[model samples]
Target: MTVDPSLSEEIIARAQSYPGIRAGIARLKDVLKAPSYQVVPEGEWSTSLSVLQESTVPEWPPEARSVLVLGLHHPKNDPRLDWWDRGNTNGNRRLMEISESLKQWLRKELHLGAYPLPYHVEWGGLFLKDAAVLAGLGIIGKSNLLLHPEWGPQIRLRSILIEGDLQPNEPIEGFFPCETCDVLCHKVCPQNAFSSGAYRRPSCIAQIDSNVANKVPGGEIDENGNSILVIKYCRACELACPAGK
Candidate 1:
């Protein structure tokens, strides 16, 4: 079936209609050439229980023409959104639900093929921060987080691959939030991830490893009144940033 030429607007509008969601589009070809794709993915124990595993590569669909990137703001007040439990975070689960709903809507109403991508780059997922930036959602700040205009670096991202072509959003220009700042985000890191003037991914991963070692009980309780232990990942750099406050 031929795709609706005006489907991009509808898709973005429908996605943003959900509370606290911000959406944008990027051409699959452009996203393939994104900076993140140029580098090799690291094999580490950041979230997955496996330690020092081989990097997982995604098998991109040959016919996919565009990507719809979604970002859900993670406020500091609601830290649970970023906590990991049973291998997933509440924020990521929320994004998955939203992506699934939008994918079904496109397939059923518009006769378009859409599939939600996974969250982990090791699990066949796109580098979401790269996709989000290409989709005009935000800029990658010094802390190595996507800095949205309104949410700064406090947003979680996900994406969907679409068989039909959609117009890519223009990336944000001249919006470097860290350019004039004192880099407080860097100073706040427990692992000194930015000590070398560039983000040391290994250092950051070490903190995540620590968070896993010191897991906390989640708010929800099971039928036995025993709550699952959730990993509260470190976000000192993200919280120290004054940008979206």
Candidate 2:
């Protein structure tokens, strides 16, 4: 059975219509085999938290054959995108809304199941970086973030599982933006997270932990119209990268 390319294209168009969001399609099997998905994160610099129960995991629906990976560009130095207020950031909430909108659109128009998975894999979500790469979005750059052709590593990734198998896009070939550069991402890191090819997650987390401890106040306005403290996570390495500038 030949899959209609327009179906995938239409789905992507619907997703990208929303500001700062881009979408691409990948095969579910390909996403599952991608690097991050296969890595257990059991090493000394492990980033994975305690895994949730199988019941809580967002397992692929039987009819779900195509993966739609959405990336919301969180541009460099865009403080509004990363500002955490209460339990969510503005960028994050916007992406969540987009996911819901797509899910509803699929159900109402196509009469299909569109499972919008969580952003975190530990909580029943897919490894978004892997999914994005498989979806023909961009490559995993030297700093280990998915560097898009346009948005670079500044893009925040999310994925949705569509009901029918759709045509997958070919991965970009012969593109290596990281190779020609001086690799400023590692050098700019305060904690030296990317000291070498291996990013020291422990050091990175330590910086984040310190940022949380010394939360900066008055960044976010609370529901009661009060100014609340906010933790501005370190993005020095992310910002230093010339990509998406």
Candidate 3:
């Protein structure tokens, strides 16, 4: 069957219909080959887990030809969005709900398969930053975050692997904020993750470890009626960046 010329737009329309959401399409192949693709280490933990979850991938399905990447407007004022209640942050749970809703819509209305992806590349999921870039959502900035045209780096992303081979959105051009803006994102990092003009993952991870070890006062009753401490991860770099707003 010949591809529908307007399918991409239609899919995007459906995706963006959700409040505070924006959508873009990308070719699955391109997303796999995008830069920083190989950074996911073949470490013992990741490899072992990937092997265990190999059946979940199922060869990425031949019909899974495109990716539908969605970005949610996470304004700085909405501190709740980034607040962690347990293992999942409020924003992440919201993203998962939106992804599931979109999947249902595509299945019922478009007769399409939508595979919601895990956030981690270590899992059976794609590189979301690369996927976002290919989907025309934004560019990776000096802070190493996806900088959206309007939202700046203040957006949270989620993606679904779609069976529809929708047309890909062209990558953004002529948008550069890190070029001239004061690099306060680097300065704001308490861990100095960008001190040397490069993201030091170890330092960032250490800061995150510290945060986790020092869990704060916010947590909720667990499924078994037990209280759990909440650990809010560091986002000093993202909060300091003035890209979108």
Candidate 4:
């Protein structure tokens, strides 16, 4: 389906009018130290998109024109951001707040219908790193996290899909940050999660699903199976990066 012809101009104008939209985006950059940020291209992350449509959540509008993808830095100093508090409440909470706030502002200011997506595969959340790369925000490192030029692999992400179509943003051109840097992320894994290059995409997905299964009502289970103490933050890769230090 084609985007509404006027959707681009309208959304851009609306985004300009609200200092909040700009501020919100800027706040993300400030907090995350993200070097690159942009909206996702239409049809990007189709797998997750299909999951959302089939979910219990309502269907996306026919003209669901664009997505606003935001990134937050998860620096090594603040490893807690990536720690898995049982059920991943803290990380997910931060994602939800940014997503919901952006949507609320867009709805009120632009009359746009916005949806804040959940952050789980079962809940129809897509692979965030894939979305971030497609959105031109960053490249996915060998460590399996999205790495920005300024932030390395220390970033988290959330997004809002809007009903009206907007002009899609350009994809950032770049390659892996690990290309030149020594593979510090792989070396630092306590569990040696990256030891043998054992993470096929399908296996990775299964692992995440299985890890979260039977989690305490509000807890997270990392690959190591230590429970309830902390839910869902893992950052061996992010911590190892030398960028933005």
Candidate 5:
């Protein structure tokens, strides 16, 4: 079914009226340019997009017609947010907070049903990059993260599918900024994660499998299969870009 134009306008108006919601969106934009976050669009990154659709919740609400995607900038300076620290929860806390706040505001102001999604692929949630693209946030970079025109690839994302036919936001069109720049992201990886050609889905799956199989409680793993808990940050590709910095 198509989104109801009037309903969408109403929702947009209401969303704009909420100071918290507006502030949160502003914070997201600010964080993207904070020298640490990146913005990748969704359409260009089909591999990640495919994975996300496959992971989305099997049964979405009948009324869930549009999605409101939110992003949190995770700059390299604050590397801890990307870490699977303690219970693998620290990195996701910001996402959780944004989702919760958005949901609360939507429910209170618009009387709409919203579902806060999870990050893991196994949990049936779509990729943040895909949602961001649909939400007109950014394009997906070769590095596999969402890249915004203003903020390269240093952002975290959260999304909620609304259970009402709302107007979908216009998407950013025909913007490819990474084409002329030298590929610096590939050069900066300490682990040379991008040394090979673009990531092959099968290869990545195999590597992740190997990682999970060898993972020991509270320890790290290197190529030799030793437990060290180093948790390498893979933002080399993101850091290599000169966009939002």
Candidate 6:
């Protein structure tokens, strides 16, 4: 069940070949024990969302040995990347399509078992930021978002579970993006989510709930020529960071 370094590199290269994508690998066990799991126990009722949904306790497959984490850059100029229609965002849908394509290639071309995970933890998905950190994709900044070296907080993540153990990427060394800065991200938070010196999920969720309540008319018109509604979630904290801009 072990994969050689060459094979691992190949998989990573394949993932990154997609537009605006960056990829890394991590041990499944390491990701399962990520710091987020310590703060919030699995199967608990999630309060971060406006909707009522219990967090799915991860019951990952026994054979899963490695995680292939994929990050998609969401630059500030393109606000549409994070726009929500129906139940998902355009960025998230693109990630899903990429993961599914990689999964099929893994099975058919490499004969490896790959499982593409969902975007929501309530829908049997892993904690993507945690996994991305463990995969050496980025570091969690003051914004409470995964900040890549080149993209800062303007990146979204998705992951695929691999049956074979792949070489794990190491976290960046001596790279602290938030130190000695004015922390403009915190100041820009409409909810002051970081006012307590740390990210408050409740405060953040309050803003998200408000966004859901005040959805705007989307560019696309419906059958009756009425514009469809879309939820544009708050990104003040994420966009204010000047680290990777």
lDDT of 5 by residue, 1-245 (tens): 56456665565455445322311121123223432235332222122434323234666666665666666666667776775433443446766666677688778887888777666534645555666776677776666567776557877766676775555665578877767667676666555556674533443444444444453434446579866452333455677777654
Alpha carbon RMSD to native, model 2: 3.3
* Prediction 3 TM-score vs. true: 0.87
Alpha-carbon TM-score of each model against the true structure: 0.90, 0.89, 0.87, 0.63, 0.65, 0.91
Which runs of model 1 end up more than 4 angstroms from their true locations? 1-5, 41-43, 46-58
lDDT per residue as tens, model 2, 1-245: 79989888888888999988888999988888878766657424222332211123446678887889999999865777887655666777787789889999988987879988876676668888888888888998888788888877888887888988888888877768898889989888888887766687778878887876787884658789877887788888778778754
**Model 6 C-alpha lDDT per residue in residues 200-237, reported as the tens digit of each score:** 88788889988988999879998999999999999999
> RMSDs, each prediction?
3.5, 3.3, 3.7, 9.4, 9.4, 3.3
The CA lDDT of each predicted structure is: 0.85, 0.80, 0.81, 0.54, 0.57, 0.84
Pairwise lDDT winner, candidates 1 and 2: 1
The lowest-lDDT stretch of 10 consecutive residues in candidate 5 is 19-28
| Regions more than 4 Å wrong, model 2 | 42-58, 221-226
Give the range where candidate 6 is weakest over 10 consecutive residues by summed lDDT: 48-57
Q: What overall lDDT, based on C-alpha atoms, would model 1 receive against the true structure?
A: 0.85
The parts of candidate 6 lying over 4 Å away from their true place are: 1-3, 41-59
Ranking 1 against 4 by lDDT, winner: 1
On lDDT, who's better, 3 or 6?
Answer: 6
- Off-target runs (Cα >4 Å) in candidate 4 are 1-58, 174-176, 195-228
* Residue 29 in candidate 5, Cα distance off native in Å: 26
**Residue range 210-237, candidate 1, lDDT tens digits:** 8888988887787897987888989899
